[model samples]
Target: MSTPRNVQQLFDLTGRVALVTGGSRGLGLQMAMALGEAGAKVVISSRKAADLEQAVMTLQDAGIDARWVAADASKPEDINRMVDETMERLGHIDILVNNAGATWGAAAEEYPLEAWDKVMNLNVRGYFLLSQAVAQRSMIPRKQGRIINVASIAGLGGNHPMMRTIAYNTSKGAVINFTRALACEWGHKGIRVNAIAPGFFPSKMTAGTLAAVGEEQMAAHAPLLRLGDDEDLKGATLLFASEAGKHITGQILAVDGGVSAVTGG
Candidate 1:
């Protein structure tokens, strides 16, 4: 027999609380809005208080119950404070989105050591540390939680000759494996760890590169002949956050417009 349907199973998140790092703007804000639209109370955090305030207001104007906290993900103390404050205010955290990241662009031969460390510190070290804090504080005791890390397609394979981001690419690759490793260890604890590797999207991070290369050229390179849109992130994020993905873990779900499938396009 098939499963039965009830009001409780309608992808409703009536009392869930979500903490989204880097939610002040870009893809982080988009994911926060999606979670709020699904009925979860969202806490958005970033290094800039101004941006966080603006984003909180924007979410409120849209009828979502949202709050903001200013913290640098790259700083361990700040990350700890953010998680503690979220718990204090929200009472519990059911979902955590590690969307904070940094990227650097330089040729492999000439990549600055400082640039490499900065990227790795924020993208890799900060990500793991924040996730650890959340897990220990909430997920571990409850024996249930959802963690989503925002990686990139650069992590999947080497970039084309036209683009180069050695540090960013390497950091993302670490994130991908980290997701799998943590999932393996925590699966028995009812904690799900997964990653989203997005393709080209119009975000501040990609703006300079896209402008330099031109959209036409970028689109032509993608198999879908286009970049990712806002809506592309909504469904996947919801799936992992909601019961729809209750059995899935350690997955690297790509939101690319068919870019990862091409061998040589």
Candidate 2:
């Protein structure tokens, strides 16, 4: 057996390369900062070049080796191109954070099929395609990789009666299982798959929901009596991406400030 590493050593990501989708802002950018701060070279991707350029500048200001690629994670061709470009630039991928997602607000009965398809395509299908492409091209051959999927408390079960997002809930639920199934299949291939299910965090995606349900009301619902902040996800993101969590796989960790703990999400 090998000697156990120190905590700092276990969490260090020196010389690694991380690719984060939907990384222009919000949770995706949060996770990217965590990885880059830990010494990994990070490449962030999104559909908007201007947003990505701004994000990359912010990351660079923090002393992180970072770059950006503008590609829509929802499209297969985009996914392939992004992966190919990253591989060409970075040589190999050590971590993949599948954080790109979409949501639609409509009652189950009145939900449009187009909306459902859009959410599912970007949220579920995009993750699978990106994972497959990254693995087949880089991770598999190296026999080492870390995949962190961004799930949500919404995936645990139904949301508040006021929230009408059947497709979002469904896609996230699928993501949870996808993490488990992919972890099981890829374990022997040296890839660890895990997920982070966040509760209400103020972001571009949840801005509407936050406005609909007053932030204070949402905060009160959580046992912690507050919503997640910018730094909330850093610890978990580093854990899953670094050697600190080497033995951990196929787990759904809810970073919801105990909301999921009480609500059973």
Candidate 3:
């Protein structure tokens, strides 16, 4: 018998299905495209129907099988429907990317309770709840799936005095730990859970900061001497979604271009 020619095929995702929350724009859209390019049928969801439709078109134009579902991660009913619809439409969700999140900025002393609750509700609570629903309903029964939580470097360190976003930092910090804890519990079930902590990327969330300070500001603190570009997300995301990362779980992979290593340096 002859050996097959398909060597190094661990990264292929030809028959998988992926569900990405907040996939209408920014990093979520980027990751969705990456997965689609890797041969997975992608389901993108967000609070806005118009944007989700537009994203679907964009992904389709790229020759990728993409669909859209409008749902707010913060709402329990919406979360349930999102998962249900994905399963009903796509048949099964082999991968779940918890990328829908928000941030509010205000000094700690002046931060309002409402703001904190809002941020935590979606970033931490919603992320975990949606993951739980998916795990119990789809992954646990099949005993196979991958969950990737999008976190931030802000979670790895204390608040930067330059920017006051206490609630955002706290929520991201919780997400990192949440990934670790959930991976521990779900690993034995053949479900791999992990997190990706990205550095400064040019997205709607960072538009204000990047415009106000420019690339010089981002490079000053980052060891890479440059802000994150669109292509930076592809490799890290594909690694986790593919067999290349089969042994990795409960890990927080920092794709921040060496920013996490600097400590008051």
Q: Return the top candidate by lDDT.
A: 2
* Per-residue accuracy of model 2 over 1-265 as CA lDDT, tens digit each: 9998999999999999999999989999999999999999999999999999999999999999999999999999999999999999999999999999999899899999999999999999999999999999999999999999999999998888888999999999999999999999999999999999999999989998899989999999998999999999999999999999999999999999899888777
257 in model 2: Cα distance from truth in Å? Answer: 0.9
Off by over 4 Å in 1: 1-3, 6-10
lDDT string, candidate 3, 1-265, tens digits: 8554352478888999999999999899999999999999999999999999999999999999999999999999999999999999978889999999998878799999999999999999999889999998899999999999999999998855566789898899999999999999999999999999998898898776677678687778888787788788888898888888999999998888888999521
| TM-scores, one per candidate | 0.96, 0.99, 0.95
TM-score winner among the candidates? 2
Give per-residue lDDT, candidate 3, residue 52.
95
Candidate 2 C-alpha RMSD relative to the actual structure: 0.7
Compared with the true structure, all predictions reach lDDT values of: 0.90, 0.96, 0.90
Model 2, residue 24: displacement in angstroms? 0.8
* lDDT score, candidate 1: 0.90
Clashing residue pairs, candidate 3?
none
Worst 10 residues of 3 by lDDT: 2-11
Q: How accurate is candidate 2 locally (lDDT)?
A: 0.96
Model 2: colliding residue pairs: none
